[model samples]
Target: MQLISLCSGSLAALGAVLFAYGNGLSKWGGLAVLLLGTAVLLLSLSLQRRQEKEVTRLHRQIMDFLAGKNKTPKFSVNDDLFAVLENSVVELESRLLLERENTRKSSKRNADFITDVSHQLKTPLAALKLYCEMDQARNLGAHSQKQLALIERMEHLIYSLLRLEKLRADVYELQFAKHDLSRLLEQVWEELKVLYPEKKFTIIGTAELRCDAYWLHEAVKNVIKNACEHTTAAGHIQVLLETSETVVTLSIEDDGGGIAETELPKLFQRFYRTAQTKASGGAGIGLAITKTIVEKHHGTIAAENTAHGLRIVMCFPILDGVLAAG
Candidate 1:
């Protein structure tokens, strides 16, 4: 750069000398030299700005890195322009390692809590399910049947709560692997069909979707089961799928009574239930679990009401894979 600047100055001075002698076009020559000097200055400044920006960008990325410490894996940015980025990344990673240690301790506590609760609940729940299946169950009337059904619902609630708490402690347990989405959805549908024998379900797309097979399966199953629990016996549930180069969307719609409009926003929060059916079996964590699993895969889930009933929509990115759109 210095050599270029010196060369430009020499040309300008030389142009001045030529004009002083008797070249009539010396004025144009000098102006051309001045423009060349300006260009050199601009180039040097632009390079400086780019180098500075690379440093600032790395600094800003660190803030996001720290913010995502618990939720995302650690990352590093190594650039030749900002050699300090490597050191900073290493230090930040050491700090993240400490953070992970703290998280592990907290996770152990939560796991212990869940384990105790499950152990305590398991004994009675097992006895209840056993008693309900006994000869005494044969003699029970409709009112008694309702009581037994409530017990079964409570049993499911206990199991789901335990499952969520365990997963919540170290959510990374949700595995990701290549699997056919169509087959998984079929399995969830078959299970829900038998569970809700009176309802009808239809799958609407022909293309195969690839994603975290088991987690997606659980998410879809929970959503469908939640819909089935709310739906009437004669209602219909439709699974409409849309795919593109980048994403796959699965919309599960039911024809039961829709939820209150005001309650829609809180649907995915743990332990929150709609007033219309608080007596239903769920502890309100089903949707929350579904949301967590989807988000871990960098996907999204949303709930809406159709003219007839409720619908849950899930979208998964087609990561590192390609498929035909439908």
Candidate 2:
């Protein structure tokens, strides 16, 4: 455009000179300058249009590639003006492909490591468990009992880690079914009673929801176990279930020494143990596994300190056509 303007201005100057001189050469000289300037202007406009089209084409190619229409972009620069841009796009594509390959390899390595460790520890854990059972049969003394307890704790830790690893790697399948949420709670409560044999558990309400019965059972058991461990023998733990049009919520509240305010956010993180829980022989993986299971079922789990204790709530969204509780 600037070149075109400059040429037009030069033509005007030549015309002015022609009028001033009025020589015989003025007429032909002015006409020649005007024609040359017009040609330059037209050529410049044509080049600008072609440049615009090239840019539009390049942008479309990028969009197409991003939208997954093309795995490999077919781009060629016929003009020198776009040579730098074309090179940059090609370089960026190469780097992105390399990064994706690296990520895939890293993920595979992680999964392999978890699988190998789980397999390698199983035989030894089984043998230890068998030894503990035999020692219990023999009516072992206090030291033997302590050793058995330690062995049991170690086995629990190993199994919990394996479950967490499988969950992280998406290796386990969830069997979703229409299960009675109330019944599941009752079963878990019964199991907890048998496990603790000293704590009290209360059922407040009942509601039915669709979920993976076994996995959800595990999740709720973890929460109940947590409550039992945190509460005193006289303290009460309550299970409450509520259902709405779009969601089903199950809450476990206990009148125990509640968690510290700062620990609420970190409660669901794997291997995160508060100072108070360290002596409780908890590996800190139960809540993490529970969170992962809840999330896999398209639910959210959170913890809050109540006026007297702690409450853990898990809510799952109800899809269309699912049964609603009255």
Candidate 3:
């Protein structure tokens, strides 16, 4: 617009100068040209102002529509370009909303199905366990004992699946509070000692943070238990706590040989097991549940190979006043 105005003004000035001083040009003709140039300049300025106003209004409408202040945008019928853009945006928004609704419904249905099936299986599983106990009382052979152990393993797997599903579906309620981190790890270690009596476990350092004690306990226990399983009978598992100004890190390192680099990334995937874990009777659900729990607390978990073995690091952000007071 400015360029057009400058060009028109320059033409008008040239014509006026010719009318005043040029001998070859007719005075009347130069005057007529000057008038025409001035008229063109004025007309271009008017059109430029109108176009700018229209563009401003269009920009505001598009912003409002995107911000959810307007469901439908209005535009002048003569604005072919802007009108086309508005229509395209509306169509894209509709498709996105529809897809979002479908995803929500599908997730709800899947969660409900899992919950129903898990509940239904519980009754039959309980009966099977009862029958196995009765057979044991009758002094069943080694075969019957193996069958009972399999049933117990199945029960454990079913419960782990239910927990993982609930976490994924965002249905699990976490109770967060400031708790002593050392005490929590000690509590978990106490219960695990009976199961891995030969494996040595140790907790070092102390700190406090806001977290869901029960779920965090489960998460820490799973990591330590996993470490115990992968290590030798006399292997040492260390739990170390370190806190900085903004982050709290809990690291669990085991003397067991670290997993392959390729398999580390998939360690937390549900039902994903490497040959070593599969041989240990791992259902591969524990670490998955632990990952979900840590995420729920707005934390992160990662596994890396250490010189001695594998290290699982869980880091949590220290919100204002949460760790400072502790």
Candidate 4:
């Protein structure tokens, strides 16, 4: 194409010179040459326009394929220059298909493992619980009571671990809906009253929020349980629920011995127990599960040490179109 353009330009320039200086026959021949040059120039431009259109179409096709708007890609140009790019697209598609297959297999394996573990543990835990109850009925000494407590703790730890794993892996489907914060707090407080009959609990304020009610209740219960576990009989626990235009916040405060400043950040991490917590038979996964539950609902959970004790706060975004609290 470049060669054609150069030859045509040269012929047009030569024709101009001949038309300027030559006789009648030479002048007519020069005019024909100039006309031919102009025709060839127009033809070259037409071909260039055709190539540009092809390129634009190919770009759009590739983009659509990458964006998942198209499953199959068709390329019209068989030019050698495009072969490498075409081959790359085909290879990428093949690799993605393989990755999807591998992911499906991995997910199936994890599901099977979780089911098997849960089933195997259930039978033993049931038997242990029965035996613990029988020993208590027989009026066995404090050693028997301690053994039963240990067994119960083991059961709790196993269940918590299973739940934590499923939540962290996104295997559990959460059911999210609007739930009244005041009522949910009342339910959690009732459970806490039974769990820690000695400790005092107070609810300070209320707000309405949207979340998976069951899961959010469990998350709050764990936070309150942690507070009760740490707080002394002389201390009290307080819960404050507040909402703004964009967010809802739940704060759980305890008057127990506060955690060390350095250990505050690690409190919500999986299997992380402070020395004080470890001494008190903490499994270290309750707060971790609480954190996961809060975050799964597009929220944040944090903890800090207060003058009286440890304080934990959870914040969740208000759903769109919901009225903010006054």
Index of the highest-lDDT prediction: 3
> Which lDDT tens digits does candidate 3 get at residues 1-326?
78988888988997898799866647777787789889989999998887787678766765564444655444345556656765666676667557655865775676788889989998998998888888888987646678889989988998888888877666766766889999999899899999888888888898898988999999999999999989998999999999999889999999998999999999999899977899988999999999988887778999999989999999998763332211
TM-score of each candidate structure, all chains considered together: 0.63, 0.61, 0.65, 0.60
Residue-by-residue lDDT tens digits, candidate 4, 1-326: 67777887788888877777888999888888888887887787787787677578667765565445656644435666555676667667667757755865775576567667977998988898788788889887657788788888878887887888777666777766688898998899987787788888888888888788898999999888888878777569999989899899999999987988899889989899988788888989988999988987778999988889889999998853221110
Ranking 3 against 4 by lDDT, winner: 3
Model 1 quality (TM-score): 0.63
User: In model 1, which runs have C-alpha deviations exceeding 4 angstroms?
Assistant: 1-81, 84-104, 127-151, 196-198, 206-210, 244-246, 321-326
Maximum-TM-score candidate: 3
Q: Report the C-alpha lDDT of model 1 over 27-135, residue by residue, as the tens digit.
A: 6776666566667666766766776787687666555454443334344455563556556675766777687779768967887787798889889877876776673
Score candidate 4 by TM-score against the native: 0.60
Error of 3 at 219 (Å): 0.3
Model 4 residue pairs with clashes: none
Q: Give per-residue lDDT, candidate 1, residue 155.
A: 76
TM-score of 3: 0.65
Q: Rank the candidates by lDDT, best first.
A: 3, 4, 2, 1
